[model samples]
Target: MDSSSPDETAPAADQTDRLILEVARTELGLGANGGADGDLVVLDDATGALTRAALDALEGTQHRVVVQETSVQHALALAEEHRGALGEGRLLIAGLEDAPADLATLLAGRSVHLALARLPKALAALEVRASSLARAGVPALIAGGRVKHMTRSQNEVLAEVYDEVHATRGLGKSRALVARTARDDLRELPPRSSEVEIAVRGMRTAVTLSGIGSVFGGASADAGSLLLLDALDQAISAGEIEDTTRSDGADGESDGAPEEARAATPGEGSPAVLSARSVIDLGSGNGLLAAYLRSALPAARLLATDDDLDAVASTRATLESLAADAATSDGAVGTEESVGVDAGGRPGEARVLWEASLAGQAADSADLVLLNPPFHDGAAIDATLVQGLLDAVARVLRPGGQLWFVHNSHLRYRHELESRIGSVQQRARDRRFTVLQATRS
Candidate 1:
């Protein structure tokens, strides 16, 4: 987290943030005497600028403001910058998936009078926020988003939980959807479920995965992931990568994988078997890739990490569902303690962390890393976003480790991988996607 002062960054709040603040203060009387008598929750302030200004604006007021950010990086930055800003209030690092329960628990008897939020990209994310605010018994919510991103469906989603939903006039191409009167009948949005078939050790296996609305692709496997999976399957079939999950023609069990299938030993001028002992799913969005890895390499230690709290929680749920489905089909599966999965929460073997780009991981720890880096930084197309991930992967990969990377064809990440990690091989290429395998030298 940066050590810069929050006050210094408050001015950096963009047009959207400024308009949201103006609407809240002028239209809603947010900082006035008669308004916001109860609790106020601020959501999705990425830079902590909006949050910092809100805290200062509400100073000396009876209304206690709660600051919540889904991104751990943003949350930590805000916490570090504003140590004493929340005198009687609370700063929470949570997402729509966990924020409601967390906020409810923290504010035991308190009811939220108002919620100010920057709108999320996905309708499912919007639905989650609306449902969460409704559950908190919020009287009014002023949600702002860029005019280009706003849609009629968003209003419909909010209307499901709120009695009235209407958009305010556009200001500088940004607008706010003011929703009032929380509906009496509101239920939390359940995780969406979908079945996807992926090639596992040359076998077509169908797995059911679930993800909250906030998670990317919302439980459905994306095309890029499918391409990467196909590349992995091709490698295993060609004997370049050992297939530990191969069935023995009788039961689904491998009894015990051969010694060659259990280790990745690369000698001088000898072909290396990519039997990874430890694996990482970088930017594990909905845990789709992580869930696949768990079933494909049950003995390997897996770590699924994401920057968003929603992704972390969604990955947890997806893996838990995988464990449950596996247990029912092939007897019981014990929870592995090596990965730090709680014994009570579904049987899982992957340890999930909420961190941005392998921040705390030690050097030379992972044997294999699967990366499908997100190209977008909010609304902007930032190709440099993957640079940080490539750097982290270079540090964390061992001498004989491998990185399976997938990206858009136009991105041409081959040179990037060659320079960052080691020798890069184009395993698969289609019209839109390219899957590459890079070895750590």
Candidate 2:
């Protein structure tokens, strides 16, 4: 639902965003799409609100704006704010996760005034996305906060695709970059480096994770995930898993699938005779847990989901590399094949979804779910996302499912987890992180 009327931005518009608009307005002499039947496209995946705020600044003009988002929370917020423009076709939305392949097709030959807000994901992903925008033949793109947000690597990547990429002086902590793109060589991008691969182990199996700078804790597996993985393995091996699978959460299958069919039979099972029959990695960054799960429980079907574009792409890359590694190693052959890598780089046969929140996950589905809920929003330790994820976990988990959650030690999530999930217990804890296990009632 649109939050704002035809001519207004949402009431929650902050000062920093409005500041960005002022800079854009001053530098670009902002106006409606000037070309015949042209509409400006706001390519924002970083903050998600930049497009809305920019549109708000340009609201009274004759410009038509299209907002494409992979994050569901942001799309809904902007859509709600601009309900009138959406109904009249003056504004539109596209989901990057839903149709990543269609990005080029959507932007082809478009006379777009693109606003690339400071990317919240990795620079490698930013490069890929920027190249896509350049390939679409956008005439001009005004990047928000280029001075403060962009690193030298980021600037170089942007400069490679966009001609005359120049920056403005800082506007109180905010800055801008206006680029008149020279987009003929979009397919000619330089290769990304693979120098910073981090190695982590769950029990005896060691996996290499290569992540970009924007990923939490870089490419390395954090201590929390490692500890939780061990505890989960022990629980599954002991048959402590709850059996409340309603439906396949990743596919939105009806809540009527038989639980016995997906479970591991006691002594009757043959070559694939194991427990933890199904698993999901919530916010599976670099797919560390998924890889670990595949190594530990080879027969389990794995599904990895994330809201961040970089995390999704990086996780796919990580899993694919793991699959290739498994094929070469003496032991990982079955593990690799069982994980089921699709051609599009997803972990399973299901569509690699980019959900804004965990709201619509399959209810009562899964034997085990592993998560390390992120609490930091910028510099602040925000618990709102953690709360939301916990709620989603309760709704999606089956009667016998297990939730392995690792979070900051200081957070009061134990009570909340116990309330939503059935039984909560501390598995491990250190100064910075804590490992928790909660079984669904």
Candidate 3:
């Protein structure tokens, strides 16, 4: 074992460390290394009390000495280098926190007699690693400074893999557990899943998963779960998913018309107003607006951003399908040879789809933005997301850019938008929805 002077800069010693020391000294009856030389190693010098107590217990035993330094890289290298030197003597590796994977694997391969590790979080990865070592017939001991109420199934996994599993009384609000994996009775256990029911706006919804998937009324389901679902249904029923097209002679431009003339000419059946550039569709469930933008703004640049990765992927699929349809239509119309980009310098036909966190998107970068920002994460209404949306608008829009968004009248987002982006005006309003427009100063 390697011994070094304790560093004074370690975190202030707490009652928990003192308790660990008293328990090891009294329960294990360890003394200084004056006689009975044995193999002993001190692992983490940062926690001097545990190291001292462990060293006191193994003093004067007929064991060779090996020391593991605290640096993760160094400790791993040392373990690999001295694996052959361990012979038949027991190895004790103790620390306030568990070692990293490479070091743990190297130490386990050595003729390790005992392995002691402590960690802050009881990670699932650690549990899996411990199970593998226990299966290899290695005697491993894992202890923590605090106790945590692990799932009953996880506890069973530990009990099945280790010879002994012990948990101590709560230390303040934290708890700790110790597991010894030295016996042959260890058995692997089967994994299980559970279901949870959430009540959102008086509607019962069921979700199935291993852990509680109903927290905050299925916020994990994305956005304001039930509200977003209802909004999406409304958007679909409102014919928001229809594909709009413009006619060949709609614009008075002949085959070789100038770019400005093509811009001024209205496609035969297309909407008079071209879709705005630099668009953002928040709460864009399934990306209907993004798909609409692709066709509506065939000449204008388009950006369809959402917070849901699934929605983004779905929108991408829809846009790709639209592109294929456009390609087929081009042959019939005698339009340009290609479908996406034209010789007239029109914007690319493909839509740019992206995922963004409303609370975290960049500002002052868009010419036009659309939003159906959520009012809550779950059952509880969070006005903070409204502020986040306003902030995102301020960050992602250029000066004088327009922001068109839909929301319930009850939200009263006018004041919030006015405060962040300068003026807010209600362009349209109804019982179930209000369409508001704001412009950057």
Could you give candidate 2's per-residue lDDT for residues 1-441 as a string of tens digits? Answer: 342433243445343455555655666655435322345666653444565555554565565666665455566666666666677666666642222323455666556665545543467666766776778776666665434566656667778888777766666666666677656766844323232222222245556675632456656677777667766666545544422221235443334645633432333543222234457777877677767666555445566766754465556666666777777332232111111132122222222334534544566656677888888887898888788788878876766567889988888888889988888878888787888878777
**Which structure among the candidates has the greatest TM-score?**
1
Cα misplacement distance, residue 294 of candidate 3 (Å):
1.8
Native-to-model Cα distance after best TM-score fit, residue 383 in candidate 3, in Å = 1.7
lDDT of 1 by residue, 1-441 (tens): 222244564437777887877888877787677546676788878656667656655556565657666676776666666656533334433432233323444444666767888998889878876787788787888889899988899999999999998888878989998999999987767778888888887888887777775787788899999999888877766766543343222232334755333335653586766755568898988888887778777656678888876777677778877777777444222322121222122222467777778876778777689999998877787899999999999998877678999998888788889999999999999998999999888
Q: What does the lDDT come to for candidate 1?
A: 0.72
For candidate 3, the clash count comes to: 29
Candidate numbers sorted by TM-score from highest down: 1, 2, 3
Question: What lDDT, from 0 to 1, does candidate 2 have?
Answer: 0.58
Model-by-model lDDT, in order? Answer: 0.72, 0.58, 0.44
Give one digit per residue, the lDDT tens place, for model 3 in 1-441: 232333354344455565444433333323433422233333333354444444435544455433433233333333333343333333333221232222334344344444333432334434544554576555544344544434444455567678677665655654444566556765542222333343422344343322111111211233332333344334323432212122123442335643233323445675222223344555444444544444444534455544432233344444554565566443121111111221122333343322244333345545556676766654688868777667777777666665667777677788778777767766666566677767666
